[model samples]
Target: MAEALNAPTETANAHAESFLRDACATLDRLRAMRPAFQRPSAGKRIRTAFDLADECLGISVEKEALLLRQALADRQNLAAATSAALLRLAGLEMGYRRTRGYPAVAQSGDWLQNEQFVARNSDLKKWAESALYMSAAPANWTGRIAQALFGLAAGAAMAFAVAAAILANRWFPAESIPWAILIVISYILKDRIKEWLRGGFLRILPKMISDRMRDLIDPKTGRWVGRTREWVEFPAPSAVPAWASPLAAGEFNALRREIPPDDVARYQKDIRIQAARLRRAHSRMNSITEILRLSLDAWRERMDDPCERLRFVEEGRVCEEIANRVYPIGLALRFSEKRQGGRHLIRRGTLFVTRDRIARIVIEPTPEGGIAGGGAAR
Candidate 1:
């Protein structure tokens, strides 16, 4: 009877300890990325850190889900966290794409697959417009034009040679034999001239020049280009998808795996005030994500510059890649939501707040218009 009573206490202690460890790990991860948060304003700084967190979480959640989805019936907690974190976070942001706009919204997958994350992934349009490729253009086009001119120049020069041979009239019955032989020789000379001009002279010459000239160029990824900052507001919470709701357990747990052990350990010493801390963290996360939305949008704008040069003037392929990279990631971060799960699942994993994945935060305000989130409800 005593053992049974103690078992409950032991289990609670273990879970509590685990929770504390998890919290500490998350904070440490955030701190480790402190440089990512350094910006002009506190609000901007908050948003930058929050974006970093969101991206890291995106890797964790999808990878975890993929492993579990594949594992099917045989699933466990530690296995879930470890496997998911490895799969999602492993080389995740590194695989991120770049483009000009945010995706529609993605409820699943890592950062690379989403179309909206812009700078997170590399888009073909951006690549084509990049300064490196544009730098090669002037030389390439010049070589082609020279190659054509070579044909004309060789024809004219050879015609002169034929006339010289005809006038010399050195060979046979000065009538036509020498002229005919000269025709053969002149044709041969023309072939040699064509070969020399097309292969080694202007045609090949400009490639070297192009390589040198290519240095002073910047590639634009879109139809336009420039730099500026402005905030475009998101639709109110209702319009966003359920999966995007920050408080939904699935959405919450979605990034649980990325929360590290060291950060979790720090939280253990202060577990007593967990409720308050969680509230603060939640608000912090909300503020950060909001900033991320704007930042990503800003990044999208950066990619919109067009490459008017000969290299990337064809814009189709690059545009598609950008769309793929940015669209879904933006959607997942701002508006998508996940499905509901059982009670235990609620405590163990993240929940989406909306169908399209947007989360809602209820903000409380001081008389001064300052915001606080003291209440436990999200």
Candidate 2:
């Protein structure tokens, strides 16, 4: 009995340590390749190397989560051990970031169109561990099927209108003047019909069909397991949820006096999995994680300089300091699983952004919910 209980702890520790070692090794390899990536023609090579590294890092993180759960269930006192491992992992990320010189490399002409793949290594790994399921295709392909289906429906509506007009002309032989008038009316109505259908579909599709569908594949079995939908909207201050508005308000109140109400946005992604299908597809698989990354490049286009001059007096002497100016974007995430008595988890955080990139993120502890920002990273 003692040995059986000890087995889980031992196995979990082993897996966790293995992930740490693998991550360290991967970073070391990337450090060695940094010099090669500095060349002008190294664009393709850079993408290939980073893409592989990202995928491996994502997989390692997911496996670690699985092990972490097992260890916790076994009631092992491994908090310190796990924290140490995670701290080391973060250290590796910082070292890699400095070694790569992301700010310099990102400015190169060859890095165009590929900038999104870099600089978020740490954030990606953090989210990957919590992702509910891995996307079979790249993130860009998530909502493609739904888009094509809607477009097809609109096109079919136009085709049917054209067919009906021809049938009416043939069935009733009218005068030239009447026929011309009929054709003009048909043309106007055809466009209106298509646009009306498209507008209505756009409004209703969010409820009926997900933004993403049928693309999530099980990594182990290479079979379909689940699907997901995502939404992004810029809501008015009055429309913000009561629970979340206070969090956003507190963030702005500390930074600036007057808040710009128009800039606030909300992002939500929903994942639905057929647990029975997942169990049948892979017996060992019980959890899935969705890793979502948002790019702030567009937001940085019109940003002011990264630093500003601030003057003050200290000890009866005037002094001036150039402080790095950072903008705070309030963020709140809510997670709830579809089950009886399932608890809703809301984690609040603020993203501090500089003119060039994200400086840091500070997540507050949720006193109400038992968990922290333990949900899959977005």
Candidate 3:
């Protein structure tokens, strides 16, 4: 019975391996035929190859699920190994497609397979990456509640002020000067009360709420793998952290030789992952990758022209030169992983940007604070 259950998984594994070998050879053939990709037969051929690759993964994943229902002792371990193997095969196919210039050069090559290949690549990426699903939302519930409370307090204060004025109107009679004085005092106090509460609440709001919350889910096992909370603040130059300032100023002030400007923003992200839960949910998964993309559309809009002309005397002759203009943006990063006994890593980098897009990024050498983990600091 055990062998009977194992036979399907073994066959699927062998088929997947065989397909990987053939897929590599097919890709090589396709790359060599780049010049002829304009032909309809070439597109059809490319489409057929990827179709088979997708079918191979689909069948393998379904077969691997069977081992979970079996009473065998090593079934979970076997399933994990099989899943890892399939994921590796898919990843390799995707990587080779890029390095060999399959789709990247297709636009200029005018390959008929361009659209199909893009769609196929996106599908393969999701399958090979993992079963993790993520969603993020603004974490402003506390802010809303605080706003409601402030409104109520303001309304109550104004109500009391109006009530007192009404009572004083009867006591001193509206026609008298004393009644007029009491009304003036009540109006002034009402405005002051509203402003005072608003100022206090604004100061306390940051400590009370995060900007956003993100949750990670394992779709396969219906379990949560991790969570993250992020905060963003525009701190004054004087308020920038002591450690971050020196690094930014060291590189930023080199060009102008002046004090660092006051326009500084601080962003922080706290991530908590359940290592044990992730392992249980996805035995093949080793680590999670987080991508942070900062949009510079506003900065780009405010930039000067991408290039400027300069006139200089060269060899005693007047000559004009047009040079590309670029600006430097400094970034100081500090990361802490409590799991590694509170290990810390610091990295500094500068991004050179043209008016249109980022040109390049240059990073300084790592400092004495060793990296928390074995992977490269991204």
For each candidate, give its TM-score against the true structure.
0.26, 0.53, 0.61
lDDT of 1 by residue, 1-378 (tens): 122223444443344335334644664576576565665565775765455454445444434344433443132223344444444543343344112122322335666545554444234234323423312122245446665677677776677677656655755455576667776777677677666655665545543333222111223322211111222223544454343333436654567545741111000000011234334434442311111212334435544232222333355643222211222122222121122421111111222233222233333221231222333211
Using lDDT as the measure, which candidate wins? 3
lDDT for every model? 0.39, 0.64, 0.65
RMSD of each: 27.7, 13.4, 14.9
The residue ranges of model 2 lying beyond 4 angstroms of the native Cα positions read: 1-135, 138-173, 176-179, 248-259, 274-289, 367-378
How much is the lDDT of residue 169 in candidate 3?
Answer: 75
Residue 219 C-alpha lDDT in model 1: 36
Better of 1 and 3 by lDDT: 3
Per-residue lDDT tens digits of candidate 2, residues 169-193? 8866665767777777777887788
Error of 2 at 80 (Å): 22
Off by over 4 Å in 1: 1-28, 31-53, 65-69, 72-378
Cα error, residue 66 of model 2, in Å, equals: 28
Clashing pairs in 2: 131-288, 131-289, 131-290, 132-288, 132-289, 132-290, 133-288, 133-289
